[model samples]
Target: MRAKNSFLLLAVILLSGCFVSKDTPKKEAKEDPYEINNQQDNRSLADVLRKYSSLTIQGDGNNARIYIRGQSTISLETQPLFIVNNTNMGRNYAAVNSSINANEIVSVRILRSLSETAIYGEEGNHGVIIIKTKNANK
Candidate 1:
């Protein structure tokens, strides 16, 4: 009889917690770039992203993770259009990371709004961060 009562009591407590949830809506565990806020103190561009994000941020002088907003537009039927120095930067954008010289960069800007990504179309689904670099001659 004691074992039965104990089990019943445990179940009641468990069920009660489900009915009495807090103010925040329950969210499933998932990756969210929004988890990292830019409001924190200024560290080097590389340090800021490397600290908060789960991904490894590797390179030289400076690096950044720009968080622009996702878009609903899906105009491109095939692949993404990645522009580098005003030209198409090819499909393997991630691979090109190693090729980027951090010392040549000026500053990186992050845009976290849907309006900001709409211009780029659907490739900016999670967001699009356009990286602007200094001219090689400079």
Candidate 2:
């Protein structure tokens, strides 16, 4: 009877460790509004951008039109400005992303708000997407 009681006590002790106490902190997932990390190589830039709720990608490949969720501009040009390697690639997001080889891309940074887009002036009134390519120096 003592052996059975000992075994039961051991089991209870082991099981008690598995339960999480209320005092134990829970982890929360933080949202990144600037850049979306793409680990999967199977998907294209447009496909990856589509995963973000803030970005709306229309068309495909070089013809794709990228738009921000809440645009405050009066002009019909809802397309966000694309900047590649510190140079402005105009308002064609598709051309900018498609022109560069996927392997050459290092990271894509997005500036959505007017304050963030202020550097480009009226050109960036809509929004801005900066695509950085891997340099031979690095």
Top candidate when judged by lDDT against the true structure: 2
Q: Give me the displacement of residue 77 in model 1, in angstroms.
A: 16
lDDT of 2: 0.76
For model 1, what is the error of residue 43's alpha carbon versus the real structure, in angstroms, after optimal superposition? 13
Off by over 4 Å in 2: 1-38, 136-138
Alpha-carbon local distance difference test for all models: 0.46, 0.76
lDDT, candidate 1, 37-102, per-residue tens: 444443443553354332334463323323222333444432233344444454344433555543
Report the number of clashing residue pairs per model: 1, 0
TM-scores, all candidates, are: 0.38, 0.65
Q: Where is model 2 poorest over a 10-residue stretch in terms of lDDT? A: 31-40
Model 2: per-residue lDDT, tens digit, 3-31?
Answer: 99999999999999999899987887875
RMSD of each: 11.3, 8.5
